[model samples]
Target: MSARRTSRVLALWCPDWPAVAAAAAADLAPTRPVVVLHANRVVACSQLARSAGVRRGLRRREAQARCPDLYVARDDPDRDARLFEPVATAVDATVPGVEVLRPGLLVLAARGAARFFGSEEQAAEQLVDAVAATGVECRIGIADEMSTAVLAARRAALVAPGTGAQFLASLPVSELAVEPSLAGPERVDLVDLLHRLGLRRIGDFAALTPAEVASRFGVDAIAAHRCARAEPERAPAARPPAPDLTVEYPCDPPIDRIDAAAFAGRLLAVRLHDRLADAAVACTRLAVTAETAAGERLSRIWRCAEPLTPEGTADRVRWQLDGWLTQRALRGHHPDHDEWTGIATIGGQAERPGASRTRRTAPPNGSADNTVAPGRAVPAAPIVLLRLEPVEVVTAGALQLGLWGGEGEQEERFRRALVRVQGLLGGEAVLKGVLSGGRGPAERITLIALGDELSPAADPALPWPGRLPIPAPAVVLVDRPEVILESAAGAPVWITDRGLFTADPAHLRWGTKDWQVAAWSGPWPLDERWWSDGHADAVRAQILLRDDVMVLLLFGRDHIWHAEGLYD
Candidate 1:
């Protein structure tokens, strides 16, 4: 124990981070336990839930079977983070600088603060109570070292200084945070090795020599050895929080369909953008929150491109939400219920670990936006993202807030609503296209024009490295060039060869008939250079061009005529 480093650690695991997060966020009194599933997959189980025999690693179905009443929520680590930021900030205020373990953990150097606040017991209670005000219910553990504090927080059992080794000794070997003993049947496990070594618990492992553990377990052994004797956990982070940002829209006209949920998400995003601008923070998390009148709430979170911005943030949230909502989703066989629930109350947050509150959104009232020249682009800045959250609930009906006949219900409101209607009535919809950039094969290029939008159109805004030839033509000839026509007078009718040969026109010919000069126009003829590929580079400039009449770059040998656009 003397050889091990000392630490003041605090691990606050709320059994389930997301449920507490959602409960803290909404007006609903949280009676049900919430479990945040990572992409509908289980991550952490709540304390209340654990009492039901539901464990963290168990699958949703398995856990449900164990504790049929467990409220299985999705694991949105990012959402949990976004929701947790303010709470963390509150913690930092209480103890200046602390290390964030994750969305659910934080280890603070509390030796001085504990003394300054009067006592260890007093500080922990004050700290927990202060954070709880942010809507998240948290627990605290004060120890001389980190790993021990983690265990203390976990077991809600604390240990005094110089007693970390004893604290660790009492914990089960499985509590050392090693990989599961069984990862399928083929892979051998540490539990077997520990058993073979005659080590039954973490405390027993503490008695082994560090050199011996290193010989057996390699680098990870260093951490395990430190944990066994109660040491300060080495944080493998350069800085605290990763930068990310997300904006959400709660509900519009507010109802049951995914579309309404998506529509409200846009407005929430815009509002969040405005607030973030004033705060000078850019993040990469986009979260959505949905609430059902029946009290069920669902949320979703995501990551985006680097060097995030308000515009880029808005663009992504709109696109992704639209993709999921506008498209119909077939609900798995509950046959009787046909109506979909909607979203409500969207929020935005930044996710920058160790974010100091001093950063400003815009430049000071009179100062420049950045050091860049006044007319040029501003230098890119750093980002701080809040966790992203999304909620979708199976509600009874849309809430109608009458405003002398405002937008009506979020789903069915009329003419100027935020969402585009897709059912019975037809309207010129504002659709999206993934416009492909550059030029090569027409199949590989794009430019958003008029008419309807489709999938293959390729969004021009996305990064595209390969494009077409330089000085690309503005237009190309189409409709398979009109069949060349000539007149009876052997003077080569229709369009004359009028080229480098001379400025002349004798007679004209068209579709097996000859016509005396009605109004002779151009003798614009071009021939390929001797060294050139025939007709490939043969558009040798000519003056005879007209508006109404087409100067067909006719191909005899291989002349590919491109109409080169119209004059009018």
Candidate 2:
């Protein structure tokens, strides 16, 4: 069989879009140093912050230390999408049929745009000017493949037709992770593995036979291999979707609130997935279209690396609706206007179309807010109809279920529930704990919001000389209570300069309670960050009391003993 060819694509990337959106939300000056953080690690930084030695993956404290006046913001996907709606709108106005890869990146077919403008360069210039009109900077790149186009956009380069492989050859293997929306952040591991195997460049990785990559690296590596070879994102198996596959929902009273839209979106997503499954196919590209009561139409296309699951489909639909409604609200349109606020109940119970309702009611337990800003109204025009159409479809395969009854299915359901809860509350409402390198139990774990990257603050595999051994304490204290460790003579116990205990710990007094120490382990010295001004010198020891209670204690340089953790 012959190698598949890639299509000509043009990509546009907005640099540090999260930082830009955050700055705009906070009304910060453009010259102010800013960074967007997730999981206490920098994910994006403004040019001003980069100049001050701030970079992605740096810890919050380190970033703050590098730039004293740095303004830090949390990574908010909803905010990013809401703020990016204008930019996408501008690009759509300049060149129609723009596909949003994510909040900060978009792509379109270059062939049509280039021909209309007489040259690819001219088309790119127009796109840049369109985005600049919105007060945001962007870079454009044209290439024969989506991933290559995205990388090229980072450098503002244009690759000639049929030269995509050559264009990708010299780049480092790490570029595989450049487009997280395409390759996903999981590519970080793949890139690291490739680096360790001496495949330092894309050309080197591409040189290996497909069979070799498949046998050695498994199924996930196949997509990366194809990308290295500059082939299409997927096998050229996509075909026009069947007409009956299109799912449409007509709102009788016209839904205006975001919570109602989200509810409608969930039902629509489920119907679409069921239809696809019945047709023995899966959706790779989805087009969401909405029609307002005033006959206004809004549409967007979302491309996914893998076939979209039900939860994924719902997420994309909700995000697109949010962007549209929020953008309208920000433009001073109110849901209370006569054009909107005609809905009665979203759950199949409808009132008259032109009837107006003004009272604001709270959504169900897990529905999102309606307004973009706290006090702003919903969209001016209520949605009269919503449609989900599959632009590209691929044959579905048998799902491998776990031996013990649907473990994977249960996990997926739980994850969807968490995402729903997160939408109802905020991003930080649900948190996941990740392990990292640190001497103290509390320091060893990092709590990051769910759905964010699981990157740890420090490397867990690195050597930590004074880290606690196996069988860690069951309970970690959030507030360290000051305790008094004394010898048999009732004198305060201390640590010597040589990292040794001055006296045997015989008595423990915490608050008004006292207990006799039955046994104790040796004090382990931990002198952390000695090079920095905020260095900490502390020693820890595990102690057993007469009441059969075991606790971990830390003696700091300030001559205070605190109960750090408790054992079950």
Q: What is the TM-score of each candidate against the true structure?
A: 0.40, 0.64
- Per-residue alpha-carbon lDDT of candidate 1 for residues 1-568, written as tens digits (9 for 90 to 100): 5433233555454435666765544433456555556554566665667777766567777777777766655544434554555454455445544444445566555655566667777778867765654446667766766667766776676577677788778777766653211022211355466768888888788888988888878554556678778755444231233233234333324443434433454455556544444444433334433333333332233333122343444444443333223221211213332322211111222223432233223331222211221111111111111123321111112212335432223223443342335333453343332436533334344433224455466555665543333333344433334232233434232332433313243333334643343333233343334575543323222112323242322322233222222222
Question: Per-residue alpha-carbon lDDT of model 2 for 1-568, expressed as tens digits?
Answer: 1232225789999999999988888878778999999999999999999999999999999999999999999999877876787777666655666788889899887876777778899999978876765677999999888888998999999988778889899999999877788865568899999999999999999999999999998566888999888877653236778999999999988877778878888889989988887898888888888878766777788887767777778878888887777666555453454443332111112334543333223321122211222222233477899999998897775232334433234466777999999999999999999998887888899999998999999999999887788667788876888999999999999899887778998999989989999988868887778999987777888889986866665545578888888888
In model 2, the clashing pairs are: none
RMSD (Å) per prediction: 22.7, 14.4
Query: What are the per-model numbers of colliding residue pairs?
Result: 67, 0
Cα deviation in Å at residue 514, candidate 1?
87
Q: Which candidate is the best by lDDT?
A: 2
Candidate 2 overall lDDT versus native = 0.78
lDDT for each of the candidates? 0.45, 0.78
> Lowest-lDDT window of 10 residues in candidate 1?
375-384
